[model samples]
Target: MLDLRSVEIGYGIMDHARNQGYATETVGALIDWAFAFASVEQIHAECLVTNLPSISVLEKVGMRKTKEVDDRIKWILKRNSVNEA
Candidate 1:
């Protein structure tokens, strides 16, 4: 079963939006909102191995690589608790 306290995020924009900072900004905002308003403990994102742009966006939002499998990579960012980094 799917965990209600964790969620995965994904997005894509039109060709005209490529190279703009919208993706990074939006992802960062979403993560911040999730941690602040939702009861979530972690957020996850994944992209194809060939999709460097997607990987960079995830990194910029403080998500670190958690695993690599086949042609894709997984990333995760956990809510920083009072006693944890």
Candidate 2:
């Protein structure tokens, strides 16, 4: 099974490596890796309600908003829902 039970991506502008598509690339790779395992039925992500950028990234990677609890917005990428685009 895929080992990434949880994952988070962040931007570090101070290192001069920010906003260069790093976050998107990394998240895409992570998602691909997670799906590589046949036993991995789903992948999940969460972000604060105010984190627009994080929400955008999750959307770009084809994760759908499943639910919201408290201040967090939960997203889900289902293995069987590969048609999302």
Candidate 3:
């Protein structure tokens, strides 16, 4: 179970929309919504180690590496740690 103050986010983009910055924009918007409206204290995400595009999008949205478990890497973004777009 997740903590009440924390939320985990996940997203996927269509094959046709892969490299057009859609992932980054969607992730950022989600983060903004979570913190702004949900009153969440933190957000979390996980991506496969080989998924470089996903990793880049999480980092660009201000989530940092929190752990690594085999093939998956965990990330977290604390509230107030990012400037909303």
In terms of lDDT, the best-performing candidate is 3
Q: Mind giving the per-residue lDDT tens digits that candidate 2 earns over 1-85? A: 2355444333322347655777677778887887787767778788889977778878888889988999999888887775656
Model 2 earns a TM-score of 0.77
Best by TM-score: 3
**How well is each residue in 16-85 modelled by candidate 1, as lDDT tens digits?**
9978999999998888787875688888888999998998888778888888999999888888731242
Query: Taking the tens digit of each residue's C-alpha lDDT, what string does model 3 give over 1-85?
Result: 4688999999999899899999999998998799885668999999999999999999888899999999999998888777642
Please give the CA lDDT of all the candidate structures. 0.82, 0.73, 0.89
TM-score of each: 0.85, 0.77, 0.91
| Model 3, runs deviating above 4 Å | none
Q: Give candidates' CA RMSD values in order.
A: 2.7, 4.0, 2.0
Candidates 1 and 3 compared by lDDT, better number: 3
Task: Give the range of the ten consecutive residues with the poorest summed lDDT in model 1.
Answer: 76-85
